[model samples]
Target: MIQTHRKKAGFQHAGLLLMLLPGVVFVFIFSYIPLYGILLAFKNYNYSMGIWGSPWAGLEHFRTFLTNPDFFRLMRNTLLLNIYSLLFYFPMPIVLAILLYEVRGRFFKRFVQTVSYVPHFLSTVAIVTLMGVLLSPESGIVNLILKSTGAEPIYFMAKPEWFRTLYIGSTIWQNAGFSAIIYLAALSSIDTEQYDAAYIDGASRLQRIRYISLPGIGPTIIIMLLLRLGDLLELGFEKAFLMQNPLTYDTSDVVSTYVYRVGLMGGEFSYATAVGIFNMVLSLILIGIFNQISRKASSVSLW
Candidate 1:
């Protein structure tokens, strides 16, 4: 009997490996192979002198990036943007998922989920373009509404102060529904028995949710938060670049945009690579620190 059980376990393990094969291959091809390009960070790369053939300059590239006039501005903008997002945008999906979980009518819940997730499917370019049109000072709906209220129309896209607010608000709208999907799945996995017990104890609906549902998905929430911290410096350039002009540069210019401007557009490959590597390393360290804290505080982590 033991021998038969062992054989069954061996077959299961083989089946699991088969299922994992494609994902492993993808990671190897896309993630691992590209790590070799980190060498460019230490070199003065040129077209003729490939990554390996390029002359090593030690920390010169890093020094140049750090000492550049806009270094502090770039760092501040990146951190502030992410910090604002964390404060306002991060908790939105969790709250939304919780609200969604409490929705009893199956048809209504599904309809709401469908509508919410639709924005996530829209391309970044389309979303930004739509925002631009809606907020345009001349012909936009927002300006029209302002005029109706007897207020002067503001050009939202042109102002430096409005950039972060617009960016974070758009992010919350676009991704919150999609982000809630995972938490909703997590909510479904919770044992119904605990909820029933809470109900029996004269617990109110909100109390039951507080004690049972929230704790059930607490680990998943913590894990996502840790992952967010890891990418704090690596905000997407597409929306910001598209929305921004010289007028909004003070607030909108971030590390990713700076990299694009200096590296790809300016043809400073080595400097760009170095800046990118630095941002990546900082993210790794922040992720590690946050993960450790989560493990200690809540016994939930990404390790």
Candidate 2:
């Protein structure tokens, strides 16, 4: 009987593994198989020779990238943009989730949520074009309003100072609603009894949110934060590329954009790969550091 039970459990576990097989195979094919291309980072990457046949360059590409004059500027722009995203864009979702959770009218809440989610579905080109139309110096409503007030028409897209602001703002507008869905799911998992008990004790709404809702979703928040840290340097290449112009390059040129121009356009495959590898390594280190810190401080981490 004991042997029969063990065999049954083993079959159940095997079934679960079988169900997971497709995803494992998919990831292996798409993600792990491509890892061999990392060789490009350390190779001269002659087009005629291909990746494996190319001669090893022995850190030549890495050294060149590090010594490049735009190195500091690229690093600065990427880090600052990501930092701004972490500060501003990250919290917007949480705030929206909290607000949505507080709303009593189900119809109104659903309507608002649907409206907020519309921006996320828009293509990068559409979003950038919309921005252009809204901020155009001549016909844009923003410029027209400024003109009406006897103020100068500001060319927002052409200004370096406005690039980061516009990028971050658009990111929040596009993603916050969709990102909030995770927090809402987390909030829903909290025991409703705690909320009821707080209400019975005459606790205010803010106090309940502070003591109950916040604590309930703390683990989810920490996990999401750790995951976000893993992609600290992985900005969306499409949006940045579309939104930027020569005048805004100082603030808008990120590592990814630079990699595209150098690797794909300029045909410097090895050097671009080296730069990308550096970005990936830095991101890994950051996530590892934050994971440890979060584990120690909050007993929550991705690992």
Candidate 3:
């Protein structure tokens, strides 16, 4: 009987491995295979010569990028943009989730959730285009309202100072509902007995939330934060690129967008590759640091 049970367990494990095989192969092909391209960072790539045939460029690409006049500007812009998002945009979803959990009416709750989530499904091009139409200086509703109120028309997208606000605000609007889903999932796992017991004990809503709900989700919050902090420098490339124009370039040019121009547009493949490697390394370091901090502070992390 024991032998039969062990054989059955072995078969179950084998089935699980079979289920996982496709995902492992997918990562190996799509993710691990791409590591070979990192070599382009150190080589002077040529179309005729191909990657393998390209001559070594040593650290010349890195040197040039470091010495460029725009180096500081690009670095500063990228760092600040992400930092600002971390500060302003990160907490929004948590707040949204908390509010949603407290929402009483089913219809209103569903309505709010649906409205918030719809933007997440919209394509970036569509969102940006809609933004353009809404913010158009000539005949947009915003300008019309301003004109009616006897205020001067403001070109939001054209102003460098407003770029960060626009970008971060749009991010909050677009992803807050989707981001809230994780927190909501965490909320569902909390024991309802705790809430019922707290209520019977005459605990106020705020006190219950503080003592029960927050503590229950504390580990989850820490894990999510660590995951986010790991990619501190990886701002959304497509949205940033779409939002960028001559006026907003000062604020909007990030590492990814600059890499696109260098590698694809400017044809400095080696230099672009170097920049990408730098970004990946920086992201790795930040993730490590945040993970360590999470482990130390809360004994919870994403290892």
For candidate 1, the per-residue lDDT at 156 reads: 98
Roughly what TM-score does model 3 have, to 2 decimal places? 0.94
Quantify all predictions' global Cα lDDT against the true fold: 0.92, 0.94, 0.88
lDDT of 1 by residue, 101-141 (tens): 88899999999999999999999999999999999999999
| lDDT tens digits, residue span 23-137, model 2 | 9999999999999989999999998888889999989999999999999999899889988999999989888999999999999999999999999999989999999999999
Higher-TM-score candidate among 1 and 2?
2
List the candidate numbers ranked by TM-score, top first: 2, 3, 1
For model 1, the local distance difference test gives 0.92
- Estimate candidate 3's alpha-carbon lDDT, on a 0 to 1 scale: 0.88
Task: List the candidates' TM-scores in order.
Answer: 0.92, 0.94, 0.94
Instruction: Please give the TM-score that candidate 2 achieves against the real structure.
Output: 0.94
Clashing pairs in 1: none
lDDT of 2 at 53: 91
Point out where model 3 deviates above 4 Å: 1-15
The Cα error of candidate 1 at residue 199, in Å, is 2.1
Which 10-residue span in candidate 2 carries the lowest summed lDDT?
A: 227-236
| Among all candidates shown, the one with the greatest TM-score | 2
